[model samples]
Target: MASRSFAEEDFSCPVCCDIFINPVLLSCSHSFCSSCIQRVWRNKTLKECPVCRTTSSNDHPPVNLALRNLCESFQQERKPKSGPGVCSVHNETIKLFCLDDQQPVCVVCRDSRKHTNHRFCPVDEAVADNKEILKASLERLQEELRRSVNREQKLCKTAGDIKVHAQDTETQIKDEFKELRQFLDDEEAARITALREEEEKRSQRMKEKIEETSKQISSLTITIRDIEEQMKTEDVSFLQNVKATLQRFVFVSVLLNSNHHS
Candidate 1:
């Protein structure tokens, strides 16, 4: 079997240019994160997708399982905290839950969601559950590391392995260092990519908030200007009417007094 090098951190959803999540491919063969497409469609109000420029709709194709597997491997290799934190089976929050058989369930377990009405405890009520799951995961990772170390030790067990009589030990050391360096390089690059994606998500959410705030500010400003203009117009009309009435009254009184004197 070919050892496929997953380019999980390399690919991005074309529309978002960020790490792929729930990726969906367009007819144009361009793929974008599903949420990214929905967001762009809602905001842009355009028929064509931002990336493919092909006519788009709210319809989402089934998520790519290959992409999902790649993501899982990437997370395993990188070991970052930002990996998907939701439960796979229960599809609920796995906070303070167990990892053993049929695990990471929610408080309202009622597992089988259809058949058995199994009772479950609140996540907080079972503190040990959380610790056990964490320990299991840590153990698994440590075991894998140990296995890799054993494999390298075997490779260094013989003189033929290094193919050098005098500097065989030094050659083995170089190989070991090279392997460690490669592992570190992969991990650091993946971590850098994960961090960048997380930052983009945070920045995107903040920008949406800023946009909404700006719209409200603009709306309030317009409303205030409109009210002020209406008040000014009414004031001008009221003063002109008062002046005209006073002039007419004065003229009539003067005429009446003059006629009386004559």
Candidate 2:
């Protein structure tokens, strides 16, 4: 009954009615499968709901992850009966373990053409490789994590120094502005001073602007340089060593790609 209720839920996709895998709700509040929605959205970004022809943008698709997970879990709980292969290539009761790959083999596919000269390793071998690959991946991840933490720490220190320098610069600017103000005020009060009041005010304000801008530039310069240095300092030798270590036990594809993934 619960499954039925979920299946009949409003806005359910027609293709996958048991809660949408990726729901595409239309302007009419009706929903459809994301693949179906994509087919429609391709025709028009401003697509109307199929049910009501109401307008809606195809930019967003709603996904009910919890419902999807529940549905999947329920489906998984129901075990299927194990049966023999229906295909001659994979005889009934025999699974197609890749002969070359040392996977499960069906007798029908034992044809010398497919299994010729191929050594079949048991499923256990594949599992062992998988565990080893996973372990290596974890170690690489841990190393990356350590490097990232170190990077953050270095960046923080650099930022702190920039901030301190900026504050000191601000203090100097304030001092200069104060002196300029006093000089301008004195000039205005002086009877015979040649300086115009407006001109002095303009000069003072412009100097303040210049000082503030300079401080900002200094901070930005420091931040940018620090980032460049960090990015440039990657240890090529270390990367080569890691790649070499991984190549000994796995396929070249896995070993080569590990560098990219790492």
Candidate 3:
């Protein structure tokens, strides 16, 4: 494969613009770094190919094993050889470290006037010490990352809880409003019923008053007719019944005054 040359871009991921790391293939025949594709799809509703924008059928796309092997081979071929370094000053192999100068040096440089009084240590020891320091730094960074991750998780949980609380509060508000609406409806009905009952009572009283007035008017009319008939009688007959007629007239006058006052 190395004999058949290929461009670096051919093995690169479109999303990361770097050599594919754990490449995954989509059904659309496009590939991307697994982490890059997952990052792109994190906030999206549908999984899709990054280059083609084609929807993916599977959530966990298959790893491109052939492409991965090729990339690994390519990386190995491109890696620089780590042979013993040559000293710029003595042109000898660098095998020691100058503690005072803080630089790698050849054995010949250790005896030179420039490093005569400088402390020295083996390159291996220096390397081991530096690795230990780096390891400590890496541990601190990992601890901080863990704390950050835990905080983020807690925040996400709180957000979900807040959403649930809001839904519950909204439901409670709706239920309270429904109860208030029912109460108002009942109050309005009661008021209307009371008003209707009062109106009926007043109407019944008015009807009774009208009927009594009609009967009084009818009685007055009959009395007036009787008096007129008596007036039409012969002179001798009218004179003989004058006293009874006067008494009836006085009774009618008293009835009219009573009716007027009432």
Full-model lDDT for every candidate? 0.47, 0.47, 0.66
State the lDDT of candidate 1 residue by residue for 1-262, as single tens digits.
Answer: 0114645435556665545778776666666677877777775655476755788554565566676556556555454332233434234445533323323354424343222444445444443443344344334434433543454345444323223432454454456556677557676556556655655665566555445434433433443343333334322232223233334434533643453354
Q: Per-residue CA lDDT of candidate 2, range 137-159, in tens? A: 44554454455455545655655
- Ten-residue segment with the worst summed lDDT in candidate 3? 234-243
TM-score of each: 0.27, 0.33, 0.34
- Candidate 1, after superposition: displacement of residue 255 in Å? 91
2 versus 3: better lDDT goes to: 3
Better model by TM-score, 1 or 2? 2
Give the poorly placed runs of model 2, Cα more than 4 Å off: 1-113, 182-262
**Cα-lDDT of candidate 3:** 0.66
Question: Model 3: residues >4 Å from true position, as ranges?
Answer: 1-84, 108-117, 181-262
Q: How well does candidate 1 match the true structure in TM-score terms?
A: 0.27
Q: 195, model 1: CA deviation in Å?
A: 73
Question: Between prediction 1 and prediction 3, which has the larger TM-score?
Answer: 3
In model 1, the clashing pairs are none
